[model samples]
Target: MNILVAATSVAAVAFLLLSSNQNIPESVKPGSSAALFALGTAGFLVVSSVLALLRVKFSRWLMLAAALIFFGILGFQSLALLVSSGASLPAGATPKLWANVIRNTLEIAINAWALLSAKASTFFMGNRPNQSSEADGSAAAQL
Candidate 1:
């Protein structure tokens, strides 16, 4: 989880750098796209950290959702770049494209895991008296 957060942060930074490059298209500029990406990543990090610190059950899921959304945007941009390039992806595009796909897929899966975990937690914790009751209900229901 920590690794995922770090990776997302790194990706956001990379996107900001790429978007800032003068050689890149104006549409891909760092203004809106980079800012949004950074904001989302930051939000994910904050939410995840707070939940984890507070021992909240849904922290992982929140982080996962954020990761998915963040990487989803990047994947969409990559696809757009490929399309705009007239399907003539760069000579070394395969490795990078596949890498991005894998990363995005992983992010999606992690997000899904988080979602499931959060849902399960919420289901058991619903209207419970306290954390102990929630835990007991969850354990009892699991069997």
Candidate 2:
């Protein structure tokens, strides 16, 4: 579904931003703990998105897990943003924080909607023609 794919699209954006070093705080050096954590999280999110879109029966659970993980990350970032607000920080840091917060929030919302939608449930659980007949070997026998 378009809505489900949209969630992956947001994750792709996050992956690009993090991979390009645009989202790393200036104070954090390359290969530092914080930087690595950000990159790792982005990578995990992208992987989860791919798995969710793979049309497997377990895709709903995968999507749910990704959504929950992202929600946790968003909460952590929001707390960090609040605490850092009074401190003197790089000008670019605030905008990047806000951008990530907004983008991830949107992604989480979309994932939630897709998970709850009947269409998505059906898509995830429904067997494709080939898959449905494969178990009985009818399709293979026809060939």
Candidate 1 residue pairs that clash: none
What TM-score would every model get versus the actual structure? 0.53, 0.57
Model 2 Cα lDDT, one tens digit per residue, 98-129: 67777777767777888779998787776654
Q: lDDT by residue for model 1 over 49-141, one digit each (tens)?
A: 556545566665565566666667767766667667755776898668768877767766765665568675665355434444434557755
RMSD of 1: 7.3
The top-ranked prediction according to TM-score is 2
Residue 16 CA displacement from its true place in model 1, Å: 6.4
Error of 2 at 2 (Å): 12
